[model samples]
Target: MLRRANAIAIFHAIRLQPGISQREIGDRTGIDKSTVSAVINQFDALGLLERVADESRKGRGRPSEGVRINGAAGLMLGIDIEPERLVVMSAGLDGVPLDVSEYPALPSESEFAGGVSAAVAAHLARGGSTLAEVRSIGVCLPGLVDRSGKLISSSNFRWGAVDVAGELRARFGQKVWVDNDARGAGLAERLFGCCLDVQDFVFIDSHSGVGGALYLEGAIYAGSLGIAGEIGHTKIVPHGRICQCGDGGCLSAYISGPALRDAFRGAGLVANSFAEMKALAEQNIPEAMGVLDEAGEILGLALSNFINLLNPPNIVIGGGLAVLAPYLMPPAERVLRRHALPEGLAHCTILISELSKEPHARGPLAVALQGLSQLNADGAFPW
Candidate 1:
C-alpha cells in the first residue's frame, strides 16, 4: 500500500515538473526516503520508467544524482496516416521523441497498418529495448473510433468497419487504442500543452480538412457514438461541391485549401501545394490573405455556435493551416463578434500550439504517459 501511494505521488510530482531528482521527488511526495528508492528501482526494472542525467550537469552527477524516468526504456508507438504520408513515431519515458519514421502515401488501411507494424518492429530492434519493453500502441487516424477502438468510418481513407484495436491485440500481443486523430491530438494538448489547467475548452485542428475535439470538466467528452468534433462535414452552402465523404454543401466546399486550390488553379499568385501556400502566407501575398479570410470565416462561424453551447474559456488551434493565423484569424474574430454571446467570448484565449511540430508529434509521448499510469506499487499491471 505504501508503494501504491508512492506510485501515485511519483506521477503527481512528474506532472507538476517533468524532471525531478529522486530526493526532490521524495520531498515533494512525502514518501519515506528508503521507500522512494525501492519503488523507483521497481519502476526502473519493469521498464515503466527511466532515469536521465539532468541537463544542468550534462556529463557529471553525484553518486546518487541525475536519475529520471527513462522514457526510452519503455516504448509507446504513435501512428498518423494521412492522404500524402504515413508517420510513425516512438516516445519513451524520457518524455522526448526517440525516433520518427515515415512512408509515402498509402491507399488502404492494410498498407498503412503494415507500415505501422514494420516501424514498431524496427524501432524495437534498435537495441532500445526488447519487445517486452513496449507497453502499448496508440493509433491516431482520421476517423471515428468506437469505444473498442475500431474504425467505424473515415471520410478521407474510405476505411469502413474495421476492428483496429482488436486486430492489433491479436497480432502484437500489446495493448492498443484507436482514436480519432484530432481528438487524440487534443488529449496530448490537455496533458502537456497550454490547456493543462483549463478544464473546459475546445481544440480545433485546421488541417487539410478542419476537425475539433471537445473537453468538458477535464475529461475527453466523446459523444454518444464517439464521433463528436467532426465539424468538417457540416454544410455551409446549399449546392456546393460534394466532399470525399459523399456529403454535399459541406464546409469542405469552401474553406478546405484543396477546394480553394481546385477553384483558383492558374490564378498566377498561389502555388499548388499547402506548403507553398504557407510560404505565401508568410510572404503576406494578397491572394493568400484572401483565401485565409474565407477559411477563417467558416471556422469562426462554426466556433461561434460552439462557444454559445459550451462556454469554454479557451480555444486552441493546431495543425498545418493554423500557420496562416495572421491572415486568417481576424475574419474569424469579426464573424464571432456578430454571432456569439458577448459573455461566452469574453475570457476566451485563442492560442496556437507552441510545440515545434504538429499535434501528431506529441501523440506517442501522451500514450507512453498513459501506459505509465497503469503501473501499481508493484510496478506492473495484472496480466
Candidate 2:
C-alpha cells in the first residue's frame, strides 16, 4: 500500500510537470529517491511513461533523463451535463484534449443517464476509440453532488438523488468520479487554467445561475455536507425576488442569466436572450446599462462579503458572465472599493476566466486525473 501511494504520488508529480526528473519527482512528492526510481522503472516498463532528454542538464557526467506521462498509454473522458446541453471531451493521459463534442440534453430527467451513455458511445465511435482504452471517466453537473457521487438535486433539470458515478461505472466498467460543475471548474482552473499557481481562491460560475467553489491549501474545500460554496444562495436583498431553489432574496435571483433577461424585459427592452441583452448593453443602451449596473452593484456587495469572510487572494468570475465582464466589472469594482474591507479588498484581485468557454468540459479531466491517482497497480482504489 505504501509503494502504491508512492507510485501514485510520483505519477502525479510527473503528470503536473512533464519532463520532470526522477530526483525532482522525489523532492516534489517527498518520497525517497529509491522508491521514486523503482516507480519510474515500473511505469517505463508498463509503457505508461516516456523518457525525454533533459535540456536543462548542464556540464554533467551523464545526461539526466526526464519523464512524462505517455500520451498513448490510455485515455480519459469528461462529461459535463448541463440543463440545455451535454458536453463531452476525450483526452490523453497527458491531459491534452483529443476531441470534444456537444449535444442537446434530453428534456426528461429520467432519460438523462441513457442519453449520456449514448453520447459517450457516439463520442468514442467518432474518435475511433473504445471504452476499453479509457482509463477513467469524470462527470460534472450543475447541482448539489454528495461526496459519494450522488446528485442530491438540480434546480435546472429538477433531478433528485441520481447516482451519476455508479450509472457511468456500470455502463462503461471504468472508474468514475462526479462533482458539482463549479467545483469541477475550480479544479480545472487549478490544474490547467488561470489559477495554476494559486493555492487559495474563489471560483464563481455565472450561467443559467451562479455557482461557486472554494479552493484552499491547494485543494477544494467541499465543506461538511460536500455542498459548500453556494455563493449564489447568499441573500443580497431582503424580501427580494424568488430564486429557482425556492429561496427568496438569493444573489442568483438578481444576477443570473434568466434574472438579468427578465429584468431587461420588465424594463420594456427587446432583448430575447442573455447574449442579446449583452449586445444591447454593449451598444450603450441606457436601460440595459442601468440594469447591468444595478446587478453589478448587487454582485459586488455579495463579493465584498465573501472577501471579508474568505480573504481569498483571487476571485475568478467564469461561465457566461465572463463574456459580460467588461460591462459589469467597473461598477462591481467600485462597489468593492466602497464596501469591502480595505485590507481584504486591496489584496484580492478579480479575474475573468479564460476557461469560460468550456470549463465544464475541461474540468472533468482534472477529476478523472485525481481519481486515476488513487488507484493501485492492480487498478483498485484502496480508499
Candidate 3:
C-alpha cells in the first residue's frame, strides 16, 4: 500500500505536469529513480499511463520518455451547495478542475439536490466527459457533517433534517463524500495553500457566519459528530444578542459579515450586503468602520482564546470577510494580543486563505479525493 501510495503520488505529480520525464519526476517527487521506473512501467502495463518518445535531449547520454496521465483512468466530481446556488466541478485524479457550472441555490433541500443532478448532467453533456467516467463525488455543505458524510443540520438553508449523503449516493451511483464548508476549505489549504508548510493551523470563514476548520498535527480534527470547528456558535457576549442558533452572545452573532451589515443599518447606515459594507468602509463611513472594528475585536477575542486553548502554529482567516482583514487586522490583533497568554499568543501567526473557489464548497471535493484513495481499508489511492 505504501508503494502504491508513492506510485499514486508520482502519477499525480506527472499528471500535474504532463509530459514529464522519469528523472524529472523522481527529482521533483524525491522518489528513487528505480522506483519511478517500476511505477511508470507498471502503470504503462495497466494502460493507465502513456509514455511518448522524446528526442529533445538526444545529446544527453541517453534519451528519456515523457509521461502523461490517462484521462480515461478516472474522474472526480465536486459539488458545493451554498445559500444562493449549487456549484459543480469535474477534475482528473490529479485534482485539476476541468469544468465548472452553477445554478439556483434552491428553496429547499430536495430542490437543491435536484438542481445539482441537473447541473451535473448538463456539464456532462458538453462532450468532454460524461458522468459514467466519474469515480467519486465530494460534496461541500453548510452544516455539521458526520465522518460518514451525513448532514446534521444547515443553519443557512434552515434544513432541519436531511440524508444528503444517501441522496447523493443514490443519485450518482458512485462513492460519495460529504464535509462541512469550513472543513473542506481547511483541506483545500492543506492540500494546496500557503499553510502547506505549516501544521497545526486554523482556517476560518468570515462570511454570513463565522466558522472555521481545525488542523492538528497536520490532519483535520473533525471532532465528535464533525462539529470540531463550529467556532461561530461559541458564546461571546454571554447574552448580548439573540442568534439564529437559538442562543445569545455567540461569536457569529456579532462578528459575521451579515451581522455586521445589520449593525450598520442599526447605526443609521444603509448597507444591505457585505459588498455595501466594503464600499462603505472604503468611503471611511464611521458606522461601517465601527461595525468592522467591533467584529475584529470579537474575532480577535475568539482567536486569542483559540490560540491559548489549541496553541496552533497559524490562524488562517479566509471567506468573504477576509476582504476586511486589511482594515480590521489592527484592532483584531490588539484584542488577540491583549487576551491571549503571552507565550502562546506570541507564538501563533495569523494568515488568510488564498483559494480561487469558495473554500467551504471545495472542501468536500477533497474529501471525495481522499475517499477515492480509501475505497478499501488497505489505505491506498485508487489508480
Which numbered prediction scores highest in TM-score against the true structure?
2
Kindly list the per-residue Cα lDDT of model 1 for residues 1-383, writing each as its tens digit.
Answer: 44454564565466456456777888876777887777677776776555665555555655445355555456767666676677767776545567777766666766655666666676667645566666766677777776567889877678777777767667676566567777777777866777766767788765556667887765567777777887677676667778767878877665565665654453456466556666777777777767767778877887787788788888887664465566667899999998889988996778787541453457545644554554542322211
Summarize candidate 2's per-residue lDDT along 200-253 as a digit string, tens digits. 899987777789999876567887678888888899898989998898999989
Query: lDDT: which is higher, 1 or 2?
Result: 2
Q: Please list all clashing residue pairs in model 3, or write none if there are none.
A: 85-105, 184-363
Cα lDDT of candidate 2 equals 0.81
List the lowest-lDDT window of 10 residues for candidate 3.
Answer: 374-383
TM of each candidate vs. truth: 0.79, 0.90, 0.82
Q: Residue-wise lDDT of candidate 3 within 124-230, one digit each (tens)?
A: 78747777788778888777777666778877668866777778778986477777777887777766666656767888876657778888864677776667899
Residue-level error in angstroms, candidate 1, position 91: 1.7
Backbone clash count for every predicted candidate, in the order shown: 9, 0, 2
How far residue 138's Cα lies from its native spot in candidate 1, in Å, is 1.7
Q: Clash number for model 1?
A: 9
RMSD, model 3, all Cα superposed? 4.1
Candidate 1 global CA lDDT score: 0.67
